[model samples]
Target: MGGRLPMSGMEGFLAGLAHPVIGPDHLLFVLAIGALASTQAGGVWLPVVFVLTGLGGTLLHLAEMNLPLLEIFVSVSLVLAGWLLARRQTPGLAVLLGLGAIAGIFHGYAYAESIIGAESSPLGGYLVGLATIQLGIAVAVCQWCQFLRLSKAGVTEANGSGRSVENLLRYAGFTFFGAGLAFLSGALPSL
Candidate 1:
């Protein structure tokens, strides 16, 4: 059920769009990045950095470049992302950008695995699809945070549910942290 490659550009696009959403680790990490970025002034660009690096990672894989312990790196990135969210720390822009770039490569590498045998058209479509969905998710999360006034200053309030948006985001962070640990444990055995 899993070895089949996308047969056309459209198929590749669909597959690429679905890949991040389907992978729990990837989904959580992306969500964390989006939520974290929402707190900063220029946070919207964080996802752009990730998407660009991710594309490069995919191209590197296509060029036969090897990144040892790819899965481990991906899992570790998730752990770091979770930590960033859970702590609610406002990391320096440089530090955050650096982390996003590194993590993007690893995640992108994993993404390329699914399109190894595809032709150029499908590959292009895949890249476009990946970029579109990821950016969409990040922007959506950023907008949501903005709409709810989820800032670092603790000026947010309950959104009709008993908990404030900031509190809910923190909970999301904790969830990502737990999920990352679980993913790391599962990834370690494969090494």
Candidate 2:
């Protein structure tokens, strides 16, 4: 299980980044939330809180809590998040935390299921891979939010506005909703 890397360091790292489930849809959702949080609150803490709550939700799924209506919850989250962002409505802290936790359930379930299926390797190595993918998405989202902030503030030569941020958030919500539907349909594997 603790065997040496099968591929070169760079190759392994890139492969980790290329996780199918953690690809575009996941990335966009996280980034959209981050951008919305940054624009509304003018701080990163809220987004960080959101991410951590998501992690907690993932842990819950792994614990086998058997949350009912998981698909409905996820779909609602997407719609609500999109509607809020499009309307430029700043969500309260409680709402943010709740939404983050709910979103985490769906994301976490998928993640835990994937890990269990790929249990051929050392548990530690598998966990590290999971963490790496999650962290990579986080970093990408944060950077994107920062870029949006800079552009909106006119700190950068690039022209960006509130509308652009709103649109991104809306798209993210739609994508998340689609993913939730796919999950519900069993088109995607479940934990």
Candidate 3:
């Protein structure tokens, strides 16, 4: 009789870390965007939109919607997000929603592809886990932004009057761009 093999503790730990570490490019993308969003608006809704969009994107990917030029889209997101952050201009809710939705598609695709053949029930659980992690990261970033805003270190007056915030956003955008590039180059393995 054939027997099923169980995962050892270390193996399990590694398996768990795999998704966050290497399975999807979304982790980096999400974090980058979260940092940028925190700088723009210190609210939970922004990250919520990001999470929802990612889930929506996953659903679309499962439906076999081919997002042609996904790499380019991600790259653009990074660039635009960075620009928005660096500029310190207030982004309308509609714009945030649109960006989140578009970015989420790629994120979801990566997640879905990573867990193919896993139990359907687990998919929801996985998404919840993903959302929880993202929320934590977003909150942390928001707190950091608040600290920066309150601090007087290197604070500069810019055209938008939120030059510090803009710098944060620019950094976030560049990080996102770098992450996307790494993913595209296959330097980071996707599940």
Candidate 4:
């Protein structure tokens, strides 16, 4: 028999937490979003909007509205977001919020796939964990951005370790690009 084993309640919650972390695309998407949301104008609200809009995407998935080439889009989003962060582009609050929401939609839809058939309690816990994890990362990034004075515009002076941040973003960008290419290759068979 190839039947799957049923998970206990706690196991379900833990699995929920682990799901996003398990996928590189998912993790990068969230981290890039966190970096952008933390540093962009109206940073405080953009993350919130991202989370909420992502929830909408989850709803769409629950309704069985699957997006084709989701993996490709997700990987591309990671590349774009990482580029934005690496370049330290200071887009307006609206544009930042829009970016977050767009990325959130796809992420949320992907997130819901693992929790299908979950009970109410575990589902609730999963949603809470998802929000908590993303928000926590966003706040952490925001702290780094503020402390390094990375978010402020028109400052030619490199706040201590600015070079380090740029290097880190560069590495992240390369990784994102590599991952996106991997996804594209994986998807080739289907197309």
Top candidate (TM-score)? 1
Q: What is the C-alpha lDDT of each candidate?
A: 0.83, 0.52, 0.59, 0.69
Worst 10 residues of 3 by lDDT: 1-10
lDDT of 2 by residue, 1-191 (tens): 13333233343344334442454445545555555555544445545555556555545655676766654555555555555656656577667656665675565554444333232243335444544666555556656766765675433334433356555655565665565455445532443
Query: Candidate 3 residues 1-191, lDDT tens each?
Result: 01211134333223323454453455566566666656455355677787778777767776777876665565556555555665556487567767876777666566566544445555555666666666677667766666666766327544446566547557666666666565556532331
Worst 10 residues of 2 by lDDT: 114-123
Show model 3 residue runs off by greater than 4 Å.
Answer: 1-25, 151-168, 178-191
C-alpha TM-scores of all predictions = 0.91, 0.60, 0.68, 0.78
Question: CA shift at 81, candidate 1, in angstroms?
Answer: 1.2
TM-score ranking, best first: 1, 4, 3, 2
Supply every candidate's count of residue pairs whose N, Cα or C atoms clash at under 3 angstroms.
0, 0, 4, 0
Give the top-scoring candidate (lDDT).
Answer: 1
Regions more than 4 Å wrong, model 2? 1-25, 117-121, 152-191
Error of 4 at 76 (Å): 1.4
Clashing pairs in 4: none
The local lDDT score (0 to 100) that residue 50 gets in candidate 3 is 77
TM-score of structure candidate 3:
0.68
Task: Put down candidate 1 lDDT per residue, 120-140, tens digits, no spaces.
Answer: 888888898999999999889
